[model samples]
Target: MSGKGVLVYGEALVDIVPATEGRRAEAVLGGSGYNTALTLARCGAKVAYNASLSRDTMGKRFRVRMAEEGIDQRFVSDCDAQTPSATVESIDHDGAASYRFRLSGTAFDVAPPEPADLSDFAHLHVTSFGATLGVSGQAALALMRRAREVGLSVSYDLNIRLPVLPPPDQARSAIEERVPFCDLVKLSYDDAVAVDTGSGQDYERWFAGGLPLVLSTSGDHGADLYLASGGMISAFVPASEVVDTIGAGDSFMGAFLASLWQNGGLGPLLRDLPEEISASAMDFACRVAAETCGERGCKPPRLKPKPPYD
Candidate 1:
């Protein structure tokens, strides 16, 4: 049977933000996978999150929030250890935020592999954190292997958090290792530059490992979609007024996937989407991301159906 939903596998943790005053900061439950899963669910996609969570209060709260957001939690597992946590300072002058993570030895650090039945999902999204964490890395790889075995489409968001990986070389290696396995790979302009250098042709070479599709987003400058089929398709959707840029990329990813699924064009769109169709899809995603930035935290407002295209 063909799968009807997307499976999102990775970490779910608390984001602790320091208050402006000397008061204690607030902790919001979030992670790259969590954010993407929530966005997908909000956009009306049937999504299931598979991740390890601690028995701590933060973890429990995360589970409750997932249910409230209509995301399936059957695949989530709870452990005795603490959930992963990251502390974010205030926004920088450029509206970018910096984070310091405390994830070592945490429950999410040792994610267990999902059951073979997980292949029932139509698509799987694995993030950089899932593939770079300790035991979680092995588990994620196992899950990816199984997904591919079942002929499920795989996508990876190169959500590179420099602080987590420490050295630049290590981060690049970790990201490059997962590219060949993904049918769809997404990266930021900053991340693309960090992984390779040169002109557009050279950038295409970096993605030449048969990834099929490469999406690179440049804040304010808009996004570019590279198809292995032929020439590049570009979208210059200007960024809306900024609030906080956190989770904007995840929102874009979720919207893109949802659009592909709804239109029954996942494979063709990834292989050879027409310029106009590709631009419209990317533009809708960009709008979703911009709306996400308008909010204080990672969770964006619910998505509504757009008017039919000409």
Candidate 2:
């Protein structure tokens, strides 16, 4: 796994949940990039995480979690600012969580890093809409550009949170700027609706413009996969008890990429992915996502000696 596997870049933060019905106030590990890296490692994919962590207590928690999960932390740097946090405001009956963040001056909001060797990784993944704003935006763009130069497959998750980003116009601009570098773009149907530059909802247009794949997931209603080659495939969500939807999309992405890697379709092969591999990966992803929805907070299931596909 030294010169192979996935390279993940983005935020690492804590989610503070207020006490609710017999539960005490608590903090949990989160952040789109953090959850995705954790899921990738648990799914048996070698993963290198590159996010700035503060020296604060929360940051220490993130470090420990990464170590316990066996994630590569070679590029996990430190910052003077405190770790960012998001306080859960409410959980609807459907188990969807809403949040309010404390991110100004936090570790992830700092200046971008100088370019480094990206030649080792097979794929690059970046998430969180907040990561597409300000300094974080610069970091994402730089990594994506560098990954492309090195021929690494790139994926972006428009995990948009209107609460933590700029206005739609600015957010759309920042987001659009980075999509051209991506081979795959994963977003919720809501995200497509929220950040539509009038074309986000037009799946065919995205492919016509060069995106190889676009996965639009809608909880319970299911997910849709559109390919640049031709056709769209719809996958149903595997039934599972809903605990919370904190990292459903992250887990889906992790499993999807893990499946592709296992089947030898993660790199150049991804551009002309076989229909069988694409369908199988989508099913594996949906299963992983449903399992995460049954957990407390982004705790993905292990896919080792035996995986769901097996």
Candidate 3:
């Protein structure tokens, strides 16, 4: 009983932006996995989200948002705990936003039941706090292994949050253990440094470790894609006005996967990826992320309609 589309596995939570001047604090839909699913669905990729949501107001809002965005929710289950939240820190001049997460005892701290089958998905994408801590972390690790056993493609986004994660040494050890299960790994340069301080600013080790692609996004300086075939593609976002850089990386990962999947390259990405495909996908991903940065929060932009022809 094979199925189509991607399975997104991780936490689903809200981000509370602090009040500024006349505006009051606002709660926005967020979480790496949820944002990725939104971006994927908006980019025209079929997506199924697998997060256990609480029966609270925030969780109800999440359900509405996902439904409005056209995401599949059959895999989403219910939990008795309260919804998790992250308080957004001050935004820097460059628009980079940090966070202080309230995750302990939240719905995400509890692992959802396993999916009935792995054949219901073609690709699996995991990320963020849920992928690194608590019962959810164990579930994520097990799901990744199951995906591999079913021959499904997998991508891991190391969107590490130092404040909420374990010590660097333990965090690094945990993340490295999951790398071998990934066909593609996406992380920020800061996350890379946090993972392995001695990586010497080079991600070749990840590429050489059997991953077909290792993508690292550096704010403003743009993103770098390292290929297992010893080739590198660097993409720089064109200068654009910024709002807040919340969810920028999640949008990038989602768009990158969407581009590959839409262009018929996702399934064979690890087996035989053409240089042209990687280059095009990277460019598209950067453009989408840039658009997201212009928005207020994690609200990713949809692909613009093509101009009518004569």
Best by lDDT: 3
- The residue-by-residue lDDT of candidate 1 on 152-236, one tens digit each, is 7788887777767647776666666666667877888776665552237744665676667778888767777777775676665
Candidate 1 least-lDDT 10 residues: 264-273
What TM-score does each of the candidates earn?
Answer: 0.89, 0.94, 0.93
Better of 2 and 3 by lDDT: 3
Clash pairs detected, candidate 3: none
Which segments of candidate 2 are over 4 A away from where they belong?
1-3, 112-115, 197-201, 304-310
Record all residue pairs in model 2 with backbone atoms less than 3 Å apart, i.e. clashing. Answer: none
User: Which order, best to worst by TM-score?
Assistant: 2, 3, 1
Q: Count the backbone clashes (under 3 Å) in each candidate.
A: 0, 0, 0
What lDDT does candidate 2 reach at residue 275?
81
Higher-ranked by TM-score: 1 or 3: 3
lDDT of 3 by residue, 75-159 (tens): 8988889999989988888888789999888898888778888676778999987886878988999999999888888998989
Q: Rank the models by lDDT, top first.
A: 3, 2, 1
